[model samples]
Target: MMLSLFDQFMSPTFLGVPLIVLALTLPWLLFPIPSNRWLNNRFLTLQTWFIYRFVRQLFLPMHRSGHKWAVLLTSLMLFLITLNMLGLLPYSFTPTTQLSLNLGLAAPLWLATVLIGVRGQLVYSLAHLVPEGTPTLLIPVLVIIETISLLIRPLALGVRLTANLTAGHLLIQLISTATFVLVTTMPLVSFFTATLLVLLTILEIAVAMIQAYVFVLLLSLYLQENV
Candidate 1:
């Protein structure tokens, strides 16, 4: 397991700093504000809707200043997501497929839940975790359930993102390798397998976007519940 961490850095840097920086700075460097805005409007039409929704979120009601946080979070999501999807393009690495990487993203969400709720009220977040209308004798049981639920958030995030990306990539890699072997011996096998792998690669790209959308939307919902 420790060696896997080292292996992660062997081909690509484990933290995805290069990819992330590229995504972050690309908007400023290559495509400056006007051009970036035009591209966002043209390519990502629905993202504007999300920005509006994030602003006008009824349950949470983030302030104008707080809107920047949503932009930052959403930017991070799209950045990582684009990088993840790019991995399907041969000789690339999917950073989000890593548990350590996903966990890094999840840890801040966990802390945000704690910090936001704590700022509002020390026990405010616990309100949802606790049973107000339940039997008093079940308090310990309820507390345990709450603890488990809180702990599960990060675990769920890590597993959900990592599993989807890793499985999809592994399937492609495995099938492609087998296809090459078959082609060398039988010649007829590679044609269909290679075609299928290409189709599956496209599907994997869609799944990458879906996973990113799911993670971000879930976090938005969580933020709504807390704030």
Candidate 2:
């Protein structure tokens, strides 16, 4: 039986239980746990260096208070990158492609940052909705627009991640199918398409890592404003 292109996006089940749970949890186990030893192995050393640089750069713009989110945000970055990269493998599910999952991750964190802003600096938070020296006639309209923009942040985050991953996966699948079909009838053309597929796969790998970074980076920026 032939399957649809999007069938790959559907959640798989075993014994009537969703495998999405395993997809989400398994990536955590893939990461190497830090040990108590003073000296680290090469892989662990590289991992530590990369994470240190990432966190240092990520929180560079924020206040000291925002640094509190380092562990949460860094862990989230790793989780996302792992899921995205793993999803690119054969016969694997990409949970982040689901808007619901993405929104579930985005909304609470976005709201928490907003709440922190409101709690710590209520006047400043409200002031963000209306910039200084606004015309009296435009104040109400500007406030409304800003309010809508503020509320749309989480939705935007979710949609951006879903759209990017979905598009990349679809494009890769379409090209791969084309290459397979052409290989028998048009060897030369299929060769070129196969080469293109390889390049696209490489590009998709980069996209997976980058989209994960951009996701956490935006969250940090939002937190920066509030903190």
lDDT at residue 181 of model 1 (Cα atoms): 93
> Relative to the unseen true structure, what is the C-alpha lDDT of residue 104 in candidate 1, on a scale of 0 to 100?
90
- Which candidate has the highest TM-score of all? 2
* Cα RMSD, each candidate: 5.0, 0.9
**lDDT (Cα, tens digit) per residue for candidate 1, span 4-51:** 323432335447645643433443332223344435555345656655
Off by over 4 Å in 1: 1-10, 13-32, 35-68
- Model 2 Cα displacement at 164 (Å)? 0.4
Estimate candidate 1's alpha-carbon lDDT, on a 0 to 1 scale: 0.69
lDDT of each: 0.69, 0.95
Lowest lDDT 10-residue stretch of candidate 1: 25-34
- Compared with the true structure, the alpha-carbon lDDT of candidate 2 equals 0.95
Rate residue 131 of model 2 by lDDT.
Answer: 93
